[model samples]
Every structure is written in structure tokens, then in C-alpha cells.
Target: MTNLDFLLPKSSPTDLRSIVWPRPMTVLVTAPHPDDFDAIGVTLKYLKNQGHDIHALVAETGSGIDKVYGAGMTQEEKRQLRVREQTGSLRFFGLPDQNFRFLNLNNAPDDQVVDDEANRLFLEKLIRQIHPDLLFMPHGNDSNRAHRDMANMMKAIASKVEWPIALLFNSDVKTIGMKKDFYVGFDEADAQWKAQLLRYHDSQHQRNLRDRKYGFDDRVLMLNRKTATELGIREPYAASFEIDIL
Candidate 1:
């Protein structure tokens, strides 16, 4: 029930980060979780090898890694451990420590990321600073609402950005299902390195199966086989992304 509802535009607005991003050559990969970049681990490494400046931004985090990753350990201990793990993984990717910006917003209790003023401000300030030539964010068609919100926010912020940026979706995504559009290749060492990255969330994987209803390590097999298949290979590990070049 509305008056002139059709008069409005289809999309919303966001301020985005500052204008200091790389000189249109650098890339920013935004992840919802700490190790999410692992989903696209090999692909990212390939990009890095290709001489692209890569940046990472995590959207939210728990106080400790344990509670954050369905871990059985104490929240305090898990938090410290996850930080150390992600830190190490970040270093392995050759990304500068300062580039891993954590938004630290809460999830689980209430998963919806409402596009309000605060989020807008935070995103705007970030965009103003990063000024990325391209941003790899969540896919709009993602099944997860939180993932969808990330894409929505990016689209809204598109107006404030002057540079033409692109967005790439990760393989860990379930909402959009197996994407068939894009694939990046990597060596066996690259696959090994990606698995090492996923190993950082020690607390998340060791959730005593006896006591928990469903507990097991998060395997990158699916990530690898799927992505490898896309590239006409049979590798045990790989990472993929769905691209939206705009």
C-alpha cells in the first residue's frame, strides 16, 4: 500500500570507503568471516602472482574464535587463537598486516545486517580510505541473508565511488550454488597453501563430536574439486569465484 511506489529507483545508496585505494590496480577482497578468503585461496594467490595488489577486509568477528567458529573451547581462548591463525594466514598470502581490516560486527544471535546509518557510515569511511579499483564482495544471489546484505551494501555504495570496480564471489558461498562463470588456476603448492590457511580455525574444527550434534572439520575438498573441474583439471584443492564486472 503506497503512493507512487514505482517512482523510486531500484537501488539504494552507500558512501563507500575513502579515495585512497590502490591506483586502480590494487584489489580488495571482502570476506564475511576470518578464514573465508580460504574459499578463494588459490585464485587469490594466482592474482597476487600476476602482480595485482590484493587487499582483504573481514566484515564481522566474535569476541573469541571459539564461539565464533562453533568451537567447544572457551570464547576468550578461541578468540586469541583465531586472531593468531588468521594473522599467520594473512602473512602467508603476502598481504600487509594493516590491510586486514576487521569490522567486528556481531552475528548468530541476530544474523540480519540491516542497512542503517551506522553501517553506511562505517562502509563509507572504509570506501573513502580504500578507494579500491575493484572489490570482491558477497554475491547478491547468495542463499545466506548476511551474504546478500554485503552485496547489497556494496551496490548502494557504488554511487559514491568514482573508479570502476569489479566484484567477485567466493566458492564458500552456498546461496548462489556452484557458479559456472569464472575460474582461476594455481599450482599444487598453491592448493597446499590454501589448506594451511583453513587450518587456522583450530577451535572451530575440534568441536568434540561425541557431545556435539554435528561436528567435523571443514574440508576444502569440495572447494578444490569443484574449482578444478571448472579449469579442466583433477586437483584435490582449488578456489573459485563468481565474477560481476561493472
Candidate 2:
């Protein structure tokens, strides 16, 4: 039997190079909402540093934030605010404007995205156009409807044909069940940098602070810290993911 050390503390440098695609390949990360890209920031940064051609496909404008914050704003105004927040955050991370796109799907009033054929076709066409080697999105078994919807859309696309791609499903606080197959660890410097990057989404930062009594960075870092501790890192941050092929 394999010497399973379930209770033993694992040591590292949580390097993901061994699990990442061996070559410089195109990558697409789908964000169900604007700031989600930051949830897996450490991992995404590592992949970008490795010369992967990464494109971000953001599915929604997070209009719900506007409904609460911008009470009387037009739909376009609400959408643009969310767009500006995400684009600014991406720029802070050194991701060029051309490298990311907003799907701008028509969202329902309660902010839930309608998982219909039109949305599916749009996602399929973009996936075909990008032809990525690796695809990253939130896992399907999540409490958040939008995240689950995004995963469902991808699964549908994958089912239509034999896609030669690797799917990387990352976790956040709302994720219900996930298996952490791979991870990337970050030290103090990286953690501080990620915090700054996350702050670019000021709406989310303020909202989190108001609701949770902590900033958005704090909330995300809390998850990272928990993952690091669970993985046996004494005092650092880590982001984990489960990998699947489709």
C-alpha cells in the first residue's frame, strides 16, 4: 500500500510547473463575474509568466451590484461600471486590453444568467476561435448560480465535439465540493501584490468590506490562506484547482 500521510504536513514550494501543460499553449480563463479572475490570481500569474497565450472571457457585467449601488442608472451605465472595474483590474495585472473580452450576455433582473441556446452558441464560437490548450473556470459544484451556469455552458460545449483541451476547475468560497489536484503557492510579496490587484475592483472591495467587515482582498486571501494551511504551508497563501480533460 502507498504510504498515505493524510495527517502529515506536506512541505513545498507549491510549484505547478509539473502539472501545467508542458509547452507554451493558448489558455482561456472564463470568469462568471468580473472579479472572479482574481480568485485564481496566483495560478493565472504563473501561467502568464510561463509564456502561455491567455485570454479571459468574462461572462457577465455583475449588474446586481449596480441594482444595489446605482439605483437609477441605465442598463448600459450599470454594465459599463462593471466593465471599467474588471478592465482596470486586468490592466493592473499587466493583462493587455486585447487579451480579455466581455461576453455581455443579457442577464436576468435578479442577476442570474439564463442558460439558453443563444448563450451556449456564443460561448462555443468563442471557445472554437480561441482553441486553447487549457481552459480554466469555476467548478460546477458551487453555491453560486452564475459559476454553476458557466461550468454547465462549458460542459455543454465540450460535449458537442472531441475537444483537445485540458479543463482546470478552480475553487472559491462558494465552491461546494472540489478535489484539489494541483496548486500554486505564493509568499508575502506575491500576496501583497495580489491584494493590490484585487483592489482595482473597488466596488467589490467596498461591498465585501460592508457586508463581511473585510475588504475583497481579505476575503480572497482568507481562502488562499486556508488552502495553504490545509496543504501544510506554515504561513503563506496558495490557490488550488482540479484538472480534467475534455
TM-score, prediction 1: 0.72
Per-prediction TM-score to the true structure, in the order listed:
0.72, 0.88
Sum up the clashes in candidate 1: 16
Which is the leading candidate under TM-score? 2
lDDT of 2 by residue, 95-155 (tens): 9888999887756565656577888988889888888767889999998888888888887
lDDT of each: 0.59, 0.78
Please list the residue runs of candidate 2 whose C-alpha ends up more than 4 Å from where it truly belongs after superposition.
1-15, 64-68
| Backbone collisions counted per model | 16, 0
For residues 57-134, could you state the per-residue lDDT of candidate 1 as single tens digits? 775554323343544765445445656667777887778888777665544445335556677678867876887656
